[model samples]
Target: MAEPRNCSECNDSLYGQQFILKEELPHCIKCYETLYCDNCIACKQLIGCASKDVLFKNQHWHGKCFLCTRCNQSLVDQPFATRDDLLLCSACYCDEFSAKCHACLRVITPGSKKMEHKGFSWHENCFTCKLCQETIGTRSFVQKEANNYCLICYEKTFALQCFHCMKPIISGGVNYRDQPWHKECFVCSKCKQQLAGRRFTSRDDLAYCFDCFCNLFSKKCAYCTTPINGLGGSKYISFNEVQWHKECFNCKKCCVSLVGRGFLTCNNDIFCPDCGKGI
Candidate 1:
């Protein structure tokens, strides 16, 4: 068989040009000459082209092209501009109906406008709820602290108070700063000393500064007026302000000058284990 002719446009030898082969083939059917293939343009795959045209600028393209790549829309009777090899139709190129958010100054669609003043448009809720960093929507927005805020933030920011120390939260009160405190924290108020672990609170709901309560009520040993050192002492007494060693306070029950083990206290008086059981 005779060798087929080469494509007039690409000049590549015709081997599988007659069949579908590797790419879509475009040919001058009248002269039986190959013109171009699918790979000639990138946009052709996205929106199919009806007919090809060679322009005076040496660019080849389909005559009836639709869809601008930049804005991803059908380009029907619309003016277009090119930037960075992508075509932007006139609507997207001019930013038609685009407006800046009044609060954030972010460029958003004009349809989102809620209020307008002095050539600026604002989202309605954002205009009222200005306090604290929050995205304000229309329904729950209100004015607070001389600024706008959402309903949830206003409650947490103002109403709640610390139960233990009675200190008002300055920041992050709702989630982080919580109510209620250790008894020791209130007792140590006068001395301003924060107790390590042990705590107590008065039944009256009055906050006692740490110093006055600990000094007045803590039990201690009679002899030393110091707190009982160990947990399981048999002898104990209310010495200065807190519970203390009773044997250290001069073991009165034995009357034999008791030594070694401490005595325990109940109510206001000291009692040895036998005497305490008899009573």
Candidate 2:
């Protein structure tokens, strides 16, 4: 029988040595690997059939060696990133590049609910009303004094309904008798003039200016037949619902002013000291 053939590259006997047949020529394991094995990018080792190989982005890696550099998680056959030769799994990739949430101060993970406005961000579950502590989610919100609030809590805390206009007063307003009013809404009910910071009177919750009150509600002077303008709150005398200003009061018979002198009323007329004695 003919002698067993030898490996062409290693010169080892092929019948017992580990080798490969290339072009019907027996090549030893050392030479076969140099020609057939691929270099693994992850571990920087030559990969053969015995090694579980993974191909990605025109590069080869040993399956067990492909892992996220930050998390150290295996990324074999999974979505991953390789930037500047650093491998990263999807989650780690997103954490490395995503924006931080303003509420929690953490990275907003991919595929997670997020809310953003005015270049600020927050996780949906982290966004909440500062007053009620309720989750605001994607619904309407209002920012007040550096705090976030939902519409309901914002209204409940800051909405001031004007008693006159029946509308919400958002800024500076007048408050009297425990009722709130817009600056423009706090006006004289009779003249419709703005009365903010002005002296005014209220009746049945209706506000009026001093002049308007005198014109509409004051009593008439018995002599002048014009409004006394003080109603019942001045130096005056009254008899049978008839009133007179101190200066207007006089003895009807002598025509002498009776402001500080003795006087008497007869029927509907007044008499001074000398005039009364004659009567």
Candidate 3:
């Protein structure tokens, strides 16, 4: 050989030997690989080709160097998080920054799907209806003091249905005969007049306003020949299947009121005891 070339890395003569050229200087294979390897962001050292490497979030790290700060577990090729330049595994991140779900009491991790309402948060699968156990994620829901409910469950559990419309009565509903009805739905069965906040009567399952109840259902009073309003426990007298107002039960001949005292009826007429003896 005419001249011996000195390797720049080890200062050794490279005479007919395999080597690498780096930056216009000759370097041995071992030195050349070490100098050009990827640098580890975590350890801030060159990661040699023989050493395992981890690439995360557009950064590189040595396998053992990429570890959770809190748990000290290797995060190579695994899910991890970063907080203020501190690496953390999924479990350690949850322990540090997650909240307990109100329903299931499980830790809710950051960057996971969650449901929130009224300042309370839950995991996507943990948020469910109290009565039905149906998941309410991304659906309409009703909450009642620490309880979550779907619309169907909420209506069935809390709201009463109007008897007329057969739908849930959410507010301002009326109760008649142990049945529930909406304020606007409580109407007369015959005339369709509103019965809420007004006088009405019920025969079987049907409701009627005062006028409709009297005209359609009440019996005619014998004396006045008018429909008797016997609703609300109003007083009336009956003789031989004929109905009369309490004030109308009087002697037919003398027109004397015969309420309470002994009375008689003859030929469809009511008479006081004295008026009956005279007749």
The order by descending TM-score is: 2, 3, 1
Candidate 1 residue lDDT tens string, 1-279:
454456544555666655222243433332232323332243443222334542323443444444577666755456666656665676675464356566766556534546654565666555655456665654554454446556666656664445655654333332212354443333444455554343533324443343445455555565566545444546664443544464564444654333444555565455566555655
- TM-score for candidate 1, please give it: 0.31
The ten-residue window of minimal lDDT in model 2 covers: 1-10
lDDT of 1 at 129: 52
TM-scores of the candidates in the order shown: 0.31, 0.47, 0.45
lDDT of 2 by residue, 44-151 (tens): 899876678888878888888877899889897688876788888888887888878887788897778888877787888878899888988878888887689887
Model 1, poorest ten-residue lDDT window? 30-39
Task: Tell me how far the alpha carbon of residue 207 in candidate 3 is from the true structure, in angstroms, after superposition.
Answer: 23
Q: What's the C-alpha lDDT at position 143 in model 3?
A: 81
**Segments in model 2 whose C-alpha atoms lie over 4 Å from true places:** 1-13, 17-28, 71-73, 77-79, 82-85, 159-166, 169-279
lDDT of 2 at 176: 76
Among these predictions, the greatest TM-score belongs to: 2
Cα lDDT computed for each candidate against the true fold: 0.49, 0.81, 0.83
Give candidate 2's whole-model lDDT.
0.81
- Where does candidate 3 clash, by residue pair? none
- What's model 3's lDDT at 167? 92
